[model samples]
Target: MLLIEALTTGGAQRQLLNLAVQLGGRGHRVSVVVYHLADYNHRDHFRGEFERAGVPVTDVPVMAPWRRLWAVRRTVRAAGPDVVIAFLRRPGLLAELTALPARRFALIVSERTGKEGGRDMKDLTRFQLHRLADAVVANSAHLEHYVRTAAPWLRTRLRQITNSVDLDHFRPAGAPPPPHPGLRILAIGRFRPEKNFLALAAALRILRTTEPALDVTVDWYGNNFFLGQQPTGRSRPYLELLDVLRETGLEDAFRVHPPVGDVVALYQKADVLCLPSRYESLPNVVCEALACGLPVLASAVSDNDRLVRDGENGFLFDPHEPRSIAEAIRRFAALSADERAAMGRTGRRLAEELLSPATAAVRWADLVEQVVEARRAAW
Candidate 1:
């Protein structure tokens, strides 16, 4: 099997790594092809992890859009694998296009984001590339719905498999931290505008003022660099929020940490996990935090409503409203120890049932087998 993706880190990278290791151990040859060769933050860590797992990994240089086609064709043909599995829209589209002549091998496309719509030309290309794939995989049911709309013919070919984390590694079972004086607010993800870290900072500032007695410290563990190669128009919202934080003079209150492999340690120390994203299909941090027995406060978007039961495991707030976020933080901070523990337990139960690595691998394995069988029958 060949797994193709751009960069590493984020939920998508971790899922791919887990799948490669699991599938490779079962007598299946697995190879990973990353498009970037530069030693950025995520790539550095991922290179080590992939090497440790004994998976054959390659990094090729292809910066431009058109150049990617040649890169895709060259890599897939060179690997000559039984199947090619790709994550993210661009790499998936490339896999489908390049695997056209290699009809004996099945091409699988995985969607990690929501319907990005016309904002990106790649969305249109993905729509056109759908028919070339043996199957389309969506991490959430909400994303599957969007996929179906993009390519109606692929509706019968679409399947849902939520992203997974290593349960044992991410569990509440970790070394305890020394008791801290303040309420430690933790957030994790890539340092992209989509993450809306600025909004989180603004909300923390507001909460500090409104609830002065609450000693609060916000710690962010996100991607070491800013979002993408270039900024999108949607970036303005995040920039505005950052300006608010700087103007209000709260830079010292909230600190951003470089990405680390042992996120479980941060989750264990955190009082609450905040996922204030402008957009998200499904976030792995919230799931990881829940598995670590930390309550979550996330924006109600896409699968968030399905994952988080308001006032149960955690509360959902409007991403556009800083005041709403502040209030939710206040509510979480005010909860009794028992109440908070109950919320954490509820989150863990949900994660065990829905987001375990074993569960995800089984689902994906079944889907890949089915797609391969269907392709054989079609021939």
Candidate 2:
């Protein structure tokens, strides 16, 4: 059984959905359990896909903290899975709880990211709960380091599977369309502080004043799901970003669009892909762009160093500084057409090497088998 908060559209959500589908295709019986009670209807964006893949999905939509645990317990007992793997924080904690004396399944909890306040008691407590897990999976080396630092005992069970992109879905298209006035830059992700669109707006302001002759445009494809759907009187992160764009007087240059199901077309349309995120384990958008043969300009964080080789395939910038973001764009713009195309080819090669979905699923399956066997041996 694969457990997650909800099937909402985000990097982590999308990655888990892909993995679930891939694992099902590999002749494994997989089930998804969603327990996010608030706005359950709005968050099940992938229900149709799960149904199409013939993977059963069960919802444990209960609001009360104790009731939610009982709901997850019932769903897990019904699934009768040999292994119960949960993704993200809350689900991880629940998976650990489900491993009480009566439970027979081996538990594996996957962590996709880490944040500031490494010494925070809340984060440390979560890491300590991994002692109940048969194995702890982290998508990036940085996250693995994070848990190891928080709880050294996790070293023996820690596993790194990395993030993956479906190459067949995100392949190179014909020569990219020419820009109308100048270059076309693309950014894709949810609107949040960590995505750093506000800093991107600041960089656009820098470009607007410093490089007046450079008539470049930015297209941000997103659903503004960072804070999720807004409620009455709540501060909307998406709206706040728009306000920042207007304040910087670059609203015309930076355009935001609704998220698309087929994002490969968006990649095909853009000259360069820019990700100015303050935090990421391994951003799915970057891998998609690379697979689509789009040159990249990404933040230098986490495992981005492995995915994007500076100057060879794409440029990396300090996401904190708007000046650094603008400077990287300038560097990318200075490259000749042939140089840029060569960079795209290098990115495509990197995608093939680093982000194969089948390979990732196989690695995950291998870990599941290892953990299950270890548990059986102990029994």
Q: Against the true structure, whose lDDT is highest?
A: 2
- Clashing residue pairs for model 1: none
Off by over 4 Å in 2: 40-42, 225-235
**TM-score of each prediction:** 0.89, 0.93
Worst 10 residues of 2 by lDDT: 226-235
lDDT of 1 at 275: 91
lDDT of 2 by residue, 28-60 (tens): 788899988465223676777788888889888
lDDT of 1 by residue, 1-379 (tens): 6555554678888778888876776667788887752334455556777888998787767467677678867877877666788988767877877876657778888888863333356665676677788888888877777777766777877888887877788887454466567778898877667777777777877877788888777887765543445434433544564566688877677776668876777888787888988778878788788788788999978898877888899999988888888888888888877787789889888888888777777777777777777767777
> What's the TM for model 2?
0.93
